[model samples]
Target chain A: MIIAFTSKGTDWDSKMDPRFGRTDYILFYNEDTQELSHLDNREVADQAHGVGPKTAQKLFERGAQVLITGNGPGGNAAEALKQMELKIFVGAGEMTVREAYEAYQRGQLAQGA
Target chain B: MKLAIASGKGGTGKTTLAVNLALYAAATRRVALLDLDVEEPNSGIFLKGKLKREKQLFRAVPEWKKEACILCGKCSELCRFNAVLKLGKHILVMPELCHSCYACSELCPENALPMTQKSLGFLRHYEQDGLDFVESKMEIGVEMATPLIEQTLAYAEAEIAGADLQIRDCPPGTSCSVINATRDADFALLVTEPTPFGLHDLSLAVETMRHLDKPIAVAVNRVGIGNDDVFRYCEAEGIPVWASFPHDRRVAELYSRGETLYDKVDSIRTGMDAIHTQISSLGGGK
Candidate 1:
């Protein structure tokens, strides 16, 4: 499973970003390989419209099955992510990427908060 | 000549100036007053008359032919607006998100997507006090005002043949919609107040007009409230100061009751006429 965390920076030590669609960076952790990756989301952050749905599509394309962020997806973005069968969990802004993943593993992270 | 009345800040009295100018210009010329502030069109409030005609604006959306779709997700990839998305087994099309760019249908390999019309808003026409008034009203929750403004302008252009003046009351802010209003305008009347916030937005709007490279003038509304910073800046920029309206209690009282200040106030009416004469000297007169 590929779990994605919206982050303010590119590293695992960076705190989670509050914005889902306009987050600065997305940190992806692969449970199978125990590897981590990062994607810059700066392009969509500056868009005048459709940032939510466009970011959701980009996540789906990157094989993200779970999204952990401070805020939930927007209306159109939530619909698109739901249609892709991707799970969304909220309340991760204060946590680092590694802490968020550990919390997700323990089932302590909130869902759509 | 087409004159677009715009301001970077809201509540700078674009509609107030526009309606008054149209009313004043109608004395000797056929004037078309288009209220392009689709989000909150209030020109009709000032000018009351029987509705002459109304037309709904429509834009194309993609309709998929399920039998012919190959499930390749090519259409989704081609849509820049994210209006189309490819689910696991099918494609999801959000009609509201569509920009009617037709990229999905144009790029579909199987020709499964077809263009269909969707209602964007309404174009309303009213004949009020000898002026042809046209206003675009975007449907509730719809954000596509530029296209409807374009359509309304086209319709107004066709209807008002050999019109001596066309005044577009543009939406506030220097956004894409403002650009849509000022694209082909021969002149722009930038309405602003004398406050700091008003001058800040006025500078931004002036920059936008300079980029458009049209003749721009300034109208200072509610002149007594703030300092003369706006005038200094306009003078430094070499933009003409067309007219100024003093801040008066009676003007506010009249505006609250939907009354024309120009009709009741002699000074304002004369100021509006002076602005018209300036426009005429600038060769905007037809």
Candidate 2:
């Protein structure tokens, strides 16, 4: 499964960005390959509307099956992600991407409402 | 000819000029006064003695059919407002976020989506003493008024076809709602006071009107209350000063009591007559 984490930087040591739609970077980690890749999220920051759903579409297109972020998705974004069968886990709380992924592996992260 | 009474700053007497001009012009010409300030429509206050006809207005949102279910996500991808989304085992449609463009229903391949009407506001019509009036009253806490204002103009076009003059009392500030109200106007009369703040906002409103490429004029209200900055700005910009009214306690008191002072006050009548002459010079003689 590919886990997507909203991050403040490209590396795993960067803090988790609380914003789901307008986060600086999204770190994608593949569990099988143990490889990490990041995508810049600056494009959706200045949108006047529909930033959340657009961000969700980015993740859905990247084949991310799971999302770990500081907060849950908004109503529209949550609906879109849920339709794509993407599981979302919260409770990162300023942790780095690696720490959040490890916590998810340990089953310590709560499912986002 | 269509005339729009607008103001950059709030409480600059846009309604005062609009109601009085409608009353004055209705004496000799066929006039339809449209109150486009949906958020706070007060033109009906002064014209309340007339009999009014009211009608509800609605915007077309999208409705989905559950049985024709194909989770294609085409509607979601097409919608720019994010009003449509597919959730777990279902499609979610939020009507409030819908812009009512009908693109979703038109693009649905399965033909499962249909246009649904959602209540936007009310249109109140009044005809008393030869003046035809209509006001757009938006529902409380509703943010968008452009649709309602545009609907009001359409209603005016259909209901008052032979009218010689159409006067719109636009809301203050040069936002999208104001653009929607004044875009169809033949001439825009910007109402302002003689203050620095009034001049500042007047310049902004002028820039907006310039972008719309409409002929601009100025109406200075409560002339004695502030300095001559508004007049100076209008002169510098070469926009005509159509009329000016003095700051009188009696006029303010009459306005407070939902009365128009055009008939009772001589100076006010003269000012309105000057405005009428300017409006008539637009080449449509009545």
User: Per-prediction count of colliding residue pairs?
Assistant: 0, 0
Interface RMSD of every predicted model, in angstroms: 1.7, 3.6
Q: Per-residue lDDT of B73-106 in model 1, one digit per residue for the tens?
A: 9888777777888765668788878888888998
The prediction achieving the highest lDDT against the true structure is 2
User: lDDT at A21 for candidate 2?
Assistant: 76
Which digits, one per residue and each the tens of the lDDT, describe model 2 over residues A13-32? 99999889788889999888
Error of 1 at A35 (Å): 4.3
Off by over 4 Å in 1: A8-11, A32-48, A61-63, A105-108
Question: Model 1 residue B204 lDDT?
Answer: 97
The CA lDDT of each predicted structure is: 0.86, 0.87
What lDDT, from 0 to 1, does candidate 1 have? 0.86
The top-ranked prediction according to TM-score is 1
Stretch of 10 with least lDDT, candidate 1 chain B: B81-90
Tell me the tens digit of each residue's lDDT in model 2 across B1-286. Answer: 9999998999999998999999998899989999999999999888854656789998888898988868888887788887776653467776767788888899999877799787888998989788899998999756679889999999999988878999999999999899999998999999999999999999999999999999999999999988998888888889999999999999988988989889988879999999999988877553
- Record all residue pairs in model 2 with backbone atoms less than 3 Å apart, i.e. clashing: none
